[model samples]
Target: MTRGDSTELAAALRQWRERLTPADVGLPAGPRRRTPGLRREEVARLAGVSVDYVVRLEQDRGPHPSSSVLGALARALRLSAAETGHLFDLAGVAVPGPGRVNDVVRPSVLRLLDRMQDLPAMLVDARTDLLAWNALADALLGDISAVPRERRNLLRMRFGPGGDEHHGPVDEHGDRGRLDRSSVAGARAALARYPDDAALRGLVDELLRSSESFAALWAERPVEDRRVDRKAYDVAGIGRITLDCDALEVPDDDQTLIVYSAAPGSPDAEKLDLLRVVGLQKV
Candidate 1:
């Protein structure tokens, strides 16, 4: 990277960091006597880097950051797609192209989730990483916020030991098999689209080593995309409730917004209303 690029990058990083608050990134706004926006240490922690590294970068003395580091910082700062691209440019790093899976959820998409307050909705990337979810989804699908960010993947939860603990039970109509197959098929499609995504490749490798069921499904070489389906969840106080799960595409980011809803005036709808009332207490 050129010296001019490094200076611009440093200034840009500082400006971006100052424009955000702790609450924006789900961090606690602790009592303090400090400046506005997130502290350097908080940014470091959120971006999975050292405070010294962040400091060095802000001081215009750090080495050129890798693309992965830039991506992490982008997410940590909740940067928009354009802003992320600008960050990569300022760092003199090649912005990830269409060949890479886009993990950044746009702000407008998040607003869409907020508007669907009565319904259970969540955003997942192409590789099935659980990025964001609404409160109602937290009630219906168990407390996903409890799951670590790295461990909040659909495939990982489906195949990992004790995975079913949070998801409750599937319906008796063989929907479980279909969902599993769909997940595998979606992963296969993502692999085809983003052949160079190391994280996606690593997830596949981990699953192949850990899950024989995944291995069998992968061997089948399913290549279908996710589609609308019916799924059942046994809420604690409400018993079994089935909802129509719809996969809405955010094509620009290669993300899908999964919304769960029940037919109007149906018993499932009543159960969902009850869930809304109870508000994750029984979850």
Candidate 2:
């Protein structure tokens, strides 16, 4: 980043800090007649930065901080996940993360998804990148488990044409565009939180290069994720498939638990049964 950009960021941070109130930070107003806003010491203590550093930062006299330090400060300030991520972005040190996913699923969460046996359940990252799913998910969908590790990502499937991994052709004029756009929006949001992440960059770049549709939507920089949404899949062998997919953030409220439900006693549900009976799907 340029020097001007750095100073601008520092100035912005100062303004943001001053505007916040005690309630904004879950703190007391204490005594009045203080600095314009949160005290340097208060912010420093909360952010684990030295008061000197805070002053230097506010004054634009300090060097740009590393992403780790920025994240620590973000945590200390009790920033909302999206807000925290944006803070890092302004600081030009965005943390490269695709929602924390080190097998962090809670047992209860897993049990909950699994219990909805009739409905295919799966957990996807903030990027709508499928993380984990029940056996029924693999069966009802096009054996995503059969997918190689690198190609397992949902974005790659829809947009990574150069990839050998194949699913039946989805008609863009139909509902595929809706599902594709929704998922891409989720992925773009995640990329914003991790702009410097090389792996994510590669995936996004690949998708952009492979599909003109992906290219156009990516440019819009949408924020349409973080809630319940559904998609219909045209799975092979099973013929036309429709899934009422919903995104549910688990206990951590970070990772997404995307569950795909078929209507009660619907054909989709019937096809799902074949997976269990035919041994075509498992974990």
Candidate 3:
């Protein structure tokens, strides 16, 4: 590889690493130590790389890191999506494009989630991966964090089993067919967006083979606009409540910010408020 800003890249990585603590990454703070931030070994463990590799990168004493390595480092450091892109650029690696699913949520989108405290808000990538969600969303749509990263997909929950009852697309209104069609159409749109992504392709292929409905829908190639829709959810302890669901697309990142809110002063709104309080305690 051609020599680039090795020193600058090293410095940047060190700065980011030094600014983050173990608690930020869901690790215990433990007893006080000499280092202000995490150690190189801790970073390596979190990033799924070896201590030697992290040392090499930080000391500017080895070859350039790969895209996957950089991605792991970005996640380990809790960098914003934009910061992750910058990390790739600093390493002379091309940023992931539209043809790839970007799981990272923009900082602006996160801020919006924070602002919508009373409403249920979530962010999902093109592949339907649950990138981020608010507490209200966890209450209304079930806890996305409880599932494995690969299985935290809306379409998967839709066609899979009743086990994911809380996370499944089915509402209290018994609209399984409608929800299935929407999932199929959403999958089609994702396929059109990232035709070359192997993971996405594998998912579609598996669905086509396993689900006859999915196969039929794939044949039809129907596309639906899910920007705004009405949904009724049967949340535990709250019975059934209908809410207005709006999906705001972030075209640049190929992600969608989905927000669900009940009408103000409606009975459903009051139930949602109660859910928020209960959900906070449960989560």
lDDT of each: 0.80, 0.61, 0.75
Point out the higher-scoring one by lDDT: 1 or 2. 1
List candidate 1 stretches off by more than 4 Å: 1-77, 86-94, 168-175, 281-283
Q: What is the lDDT of candidate 3?
A: 0.75
The number of the candidate with the highest TM-score is 1
Clashes of 2: 0
The lDDT of model 2 is 0.61
- List the candidates' TM-scores in order: 0.74, 0.54, 0.72
lDDT (Cα, 0-100) at 103 in candidate 2:
24
Q: Please give the TM-score that candidate 3 achieves against the real structure.
A: 0.72
Q: Note the residue pairs that clash in candidate 2.
A: none
Ranking by lDDT: 1, 3, 2
- Can you write out model 2's per-residue Cα lDDT over 32-149, one digit (the tens) per residue? 8466767767676545567898788878888788764565455434455566556666677645554432223344554565466566777765444554566667666655544644
Candidate 3 clashing pairs, residues 3+ apart or interchain: none
lDDT (Cα, tens digit) per residue for candidate 1, span 1-283: 5533988889889999999887676555779937888999878866667889999999999988987678768876778889888888888778777677877667778657667768999888988887777778878777775665577788898887666566534643736777777778988988988889998999999999988888899999997864788889887788888889889989678888999989999999999999988855553
lDDT of residue 135 for candidate 2: 60
Residue 153, candidate 2: alpha-carbon lDDT: 66
